[model samples]
Target: MTGGVVFDPLLPWPLIATLGLVALIGVTLALWRGLSGWALRALAAIALLGALAGPVYRVEDRKPLSDIVVMVEDASASQNLSDRPAQMQAAAEALAAEIEARPHTELRRVTVPDGAGDEGTRLLETLAEALAEEPQGRIAGIIALSDGRVHDIDRAPPLPAPLHLLLTGRESDWDRRLIVTNAPAFAIIGEPVILTLRVEDSGAVPQTANIAPLEISVDGGAAQRFEIPTGRDIDLPLTLPHGGRNVIQFTVPEAEGEITARNNTALVQINGVRDRLRVLLVSGEPHAGGRIWRNLLKSDSSVDLVHFTILRPPDKQDGVPVDELSLIAFPTRELFLEKIDDFDLIIFDRYKRRGILPASYLENVANYVRQGGAVLVAAGPDFASADSIWRSPLGAILPAEPSARVIEQPYHPALTDLGQRHPVTADLQGEENWGSWLRQIEIETTSGDVLMQGVEDRPLLILDRVEQGRVALLASDQAWLWNRGFEGGGPQLDLLRRLAHWMMKEPELEEETLWAEATGQRMRIVRRSLGDEVGAVTVTRPDGKTLDLALEQVAPGRFEALYDGPEIGLYRLQEGDQKTVIGLGPAAPREFEQTIATGEVMEPLIAPTRGGILRLEEGLPRLREVRAGRPAAGRGWIGLTPRDAYETRDVRQTPLLPAWAMLLLAAGLITGGWLREGRR
Candidate 1:
């Protein structure tokens, strides 16, 4: 209980003061005039003045509250490294026990787990939330058991008491990490792009660890090794092998005594894009469908088209001189022999053998296909003639042979069973609403998969693979009828585009492949194949663990399975001969970025509160009580300030003097002063 004197005035203070002043002056005059009762008069004036200024005694009933000490346990992924988990558990238990032993102190524990994705250790944010929930005055101190590698330090809250850090890792702990400081998200194919990387050593690194062996791999291919010096950035020149997502893995073999290999390997995914597409369009004669090929190739701003038409053969009598006739001689030598490799795709539109291109030039074309080149043949009536290009050396690479027959009935083109699953024709819109074609060349399939059929189910589209290249045969040249919306137009543009890209070796258009797409920790694994069914894919995790994941067919040839990965790193996928690598989260998780434990990150936040950082590996510091505004940490001990906080249960107020008592005292003093004056 506590008591204090308070006032409740009966009259205005100004009026009371004026009356007292007048009475004091009267008494002074009486004393100056030799009045003996002046002292009594002064006493009477004091009694009346005191009554007007009321005084009361106040009391409060109180209950003491315990001081709260917030202890934040950093249970993040980084704290699980090496022996830190053991250290954290030991420190936490010791601190809790000490707080419980101290009188008038309570321990509030907050455990911070790993943040979502690569947000890293959110120790400061967790601390701020704990502080906001408690009374600031009742909080004696704030303690964190962490490696001090907090990602959200800027969010540290204002401290009401000292903030102490019980650092978790040992001073001798070291780590080697591979960091990709600069990597472009998209790079031009066949053009060198610079990737900046560094192999860094942290903590107590050995002198012999200055030079490290680095391995680099693209799309899970063979790795190339190099000796690189640590602590400096190395610029690596990389040219993407294909157009699509290219996964590049950079690794520095784990040093003998380093903390983890997780940080030693970094994965970077760059999308490869073509700078320009060079196409050579060779037309045997000017026909209606010739413009369709020209229009399709010209529509894309990225394509460079070189078109040549054999208007008159060398054997034909033109009846006009070469100079008088407005015709440019075809650069047969430059196109077929010299610069054939410069073009990404070669298209033969209704092209038939003429005296102009000899058998040698045609043979060269066949060689081009076998040496990683693409050839697309669009057959017309000429394809079934005696002079058909199929009769030349190029027929060796051609997927089909002309049967010397032509179907002249209007028939709608339809996808074969294989075409419905092939990337070139799968999921094509408006398939049921396609227009009809006037004619198709009869052909006998010698090799390759038949994707489409026409008139009496004859092969209309055939795709094949030559040694290192690709070849495609379309038996009809009347696909332009679809472009003209005969009966109803079809997806001519889409079909042609997919066919062209597939021949050019676009990664997404491959007939058989394995790949993965990641959203947060969830991965969608996809398998594209031409067979009826594919076996389960074997997934190799970053930690050398393997699992067989079964896939369900979502489309004709597309199979998929969803997996929620528990960790962040590169994952290797394999189905049969197809293999691919995908990264689930960041190549290097933020928690493992700086695995070596240190207190530097928390020093600034702790210093202002006069707190100290002690390593748990050395020993758990003894807890002690210290006064506010003084240093809360010492050589072998940490301190918490005791807050003398209390709650008022009840309050009571009593007047010092009652109204009746004040009146009686005033009357008595006045009467006494009157009698004394009479006697005087």
Candidate 2:
């Protein structure tokens, strides 16, 4: 209970002050006139004025409240390294016991986990939330048990008391981390791309650990090793082997005394893109469908087209002289023999062998396909004649042979069972609404998968692999009829584009592929194949643990399975002969980016609160009580300010003097003054 005297005015303060001034003036006048009862009159005026100014005594019933101490436990991934988890656990238990032992204090324990995805440790954010939920006046102090590798330090809340950090890791702990400071999202294939990276050593790094061995692997291929010095940025010049996502893994062997090898490796994914696609379009004769190939290739700004038409063959004996004719001679030697490899894809549109390209030039074309080149053949009715290019040496690389037959009936082109699953024709839109083709060349598929069929279910499209290259055969040259919207136009553009890209070895268009994509820690493993079913994929985690995941057929030839990776790092996936590597989160998660524990990040927030950082290596500091403005940490102890907070249960007020008592006293003083004056 507490008591204090307070004023409860009977009238307005200004009115009371005016009346008291008037009474004081009357008393002073009486005294100036030498009145015998001047002292008695003054006494009477004082009694009346005191009665008018109401004074009361107040008493409050008070209850003491317990002070709250917020303790944030950093259970993030970084705190799990080495013996930090044990250290943190021990400190937390000790702190909890201390709070319970205190006379009037409570503990608010908050456990901070790893942030979703690569957001890292959100210790400060968690602390802020805890502080917001608790009453500020009752909070005594804030404490965090962590490695101090918090990622969200900028979100520190306004501290109501001293904030202390009990650092979790040992002083001798060390780590080696790979940092990719500069990696482009997209890089031109075959052109050297400069990637900036640095290998860093933190904590108590050894003197002999100045140089580290760095191994680099692209697309999960064999790694190339190099000796690189630490503590400096190295510019790595790399050319991607193929287009699409190129997963390049850079690893530094874990040093002898390093805390973990997780940070020693980093994965950088760069999409490889071609500078430009060079296409050689060879037209045997000027036909209606010849412009279709030209238009399709010309539509894409990335394709560089070189078109040559045999307008007037050497056998055409028109009376026009060579000088008078506007025809430019086809550079057979430059295109087929000398610079064939310069083109990424070569298209033969209705091309039939005239005396134009000799057997030697055709043989060189076949060799070009064998030496990692791409060839696409669009056959016309002439392909069934004796003049067909199938009679040439290039037929060896072609997937189909001409059957000396032509189908003239109009028929809608349809995807075969394999084509429905093949990337080139898989799920192509508006297949049922496709227009009809008036003509198709009959052919027997000698090799490769038949992707499409024409009249009487003859092979319309065939794709094959030749040694290190690729070849595609489209039996009909009348696909331009779809372009003209006969009945209803089909996905001609999409089909041709996919077919061309597939032959050019685009990774997305491959018939057999294995890859994984990640959103946060969850991954979608995809398997694309031409076969009826694929075997289960074996997933190898960064820790070398392996698990076989069976996939469900989502599409005809596409199988997929969802996996939630336990941690962030490079994951290797393999199904049969197809193998791929993907990084789930960041190559080096934020937790492992700085495995060595330090108090530098929390120092700024701690200083203003007069709090100290105590390393667990020095042992857990004893908890003590200190005043709010004083330093809250000493050599072997940390302090929490005791907030003398209380709750008021009840309050009572009593008048110091009653109105009747004040009136009686005033009347007595006045009578005494009158009697004295009468005697005088």
Candidate 3:
């Protein structure tokens, strides 16, 4: 119990001061006049004033509260590398033991884990959260055990006492980090795009004059090695071979005495976009559905369509001026023979051979197909005639031959079993209730996989690969009915777009392909195939370990597998002839961005509190108590302030003396003074 004397004034402070002042002035005047009883008068005045100023002795039953000393532990991913984890654990245990042994100190251990996404070690955030639960007055000190490479130092809370850092990692450690300073998100296909990168050496960098050899690979192809100077940016020129996403990986081989090689490699995903798609739309006869093909190609901003249409049949042309006839002025030789290979897709919409494109020009178009080009034939009534384009030199590459018979009945289009597996028609079950087509040219399948079928399950659409190129034959001209939204229409736009992309050899629209996408540590593996069943996929991790995972069929021709990734790096997947490489998370993780830990980031925060930054390499320091604002750290010891905080459980108060006793005492003193003056 503790007690102290406190004043409880009977009157207001101002009134008490007035009465005291008047009594004092009277006493001083009597003393100046040499009165004999001035001393007794002064003593009486003092007694009266003391009675007016009420005084009480207060006693408090106190309980001492422990001062809280926060011990922040860094268990982030970076700490897991090398021997930092061991060092941190050792320091934590020693500090916890010492704090618990202290007289009135509590240890609060807060473990900081890895941050979300790219946010690195968040030690200050974790420290502040732990402190929010404790009383600030009792937070005597904050001690953190980390590599000191904190990413959120600005969030350091207001420290009432000293904050000491027990840094982990050794001074001789070193690391090499790869920095992708600049990379383009989109690049034109077949064009060289520049990527700027740098290689940095940190912490006790090796004394070497040799240049660093860097290896670069595009789309998981063979890596090309180049020697580059260390600690400087280098511009790399790369060309994308395909028109789709391209994963480029840059790596530097490990050397001796490095902390880790995790940061020595980096990944950059660049999308390969074609400059412009040149499409040639040739019409043998203009009809109601001719505008449908034109509108589809014209709507896309990327497509450059060159349309040449014969407005009227040559045999039925009325007497119009030769110059007025658009067909008379058409340039057919220049398109078919001169720049036939320049076009990515050549669409023959309802075109019949009527001496427009000569036999030699038709042969050139067939040669274009064999030399890695695309052709799409949209057949109509003219396909059944003797002048059919299929009967020309192009018939060598056509997938279907006209049977000279056309089904004129209305029938809904259907996907064949192989069509359901093909990427172009997969997931089209939602559009099964499509509007009927009034006409479909009967054809005999020669070579190719039939996708769409018309009346009696006859071939409506046939896709085939010739040599190094691809071709698509649509045996009907009634697809435009769906574009008019007849009977709630169908996926006309989707089907046409996929069909065009498939003919253009878009990577994502390939029928037989393997790909994977990663989020955090989980991977979603997908395989698209036209076969009945796909074989198991073999996945190669970043560490070169291989695992074969059986894929489950989620939908027709769609196979998937989910694998929990173990590390952050490039993953290679292969199924049949399909092979793809994808990077999970960052190629160089944020944890190892600065593996060689130092207290540079944290020194400023601790210096303001007179705390010291000590390395745990020399072992955990001896904990001691010290006064606030004093130097709390030395060569071998760290100090924590004792808050000496206490809680008052119960309090009692008693007057120094009773009011009646004070009054009686004052009367006796006054009477004595009166008697002495009377004697005088």
**TM-score against truth, every candidate:** 0.92, 0.92, 0.88
The backbone clash count of each candidate, in order, is 0, 0, 0
What is the C-alpha lDDT profile of model 3 across 1-680, one tens digit per residue? 99999988899989999999999999999789877787888888888888888889999999999999999899888898788888888788888898999888888889998887768899999988887898888989999898888999889887778999998999899888889999999999988999999989989987892468899998788999999988888898889889878999999999788889889899999889999999999886778788888899999999999997877655665788777654555687789888888899999999998876789999999899999999999999889999899889999999989989988988889888888888998767565678878999999999999988989999999999999999999999988898998776788888888898899999988988888887788889999888778899999998899999999999888999999887778899998889999988888878888888888889999999989899999977888889988999999899988998999999999999678888888787778777887888
Regions more than 4 Å wrong, model 3: 1-4, 8-45, 57-69, 93-108, 133-140, 311-328, 427-433, 484-490, 516-524, 535-554, 560-569, 574-576, 619-625, 642-654, 667-680
- Candidate 1, 20: how far from true, in Å? 10
lDDT of 3: 0.88
List clashing residue pairs in candidate 3.
none
Highest lDDT, which number?
1
Q: Give the winner by lDDT: 2 or 3.
A: 2
Model 1 spans > 4 angstroms off: 6-54, 663-680
lDDT per residue for candidate 2 within 51-106, as digits (tens), equals 88888899999999999999999988888888888878888998899898889989
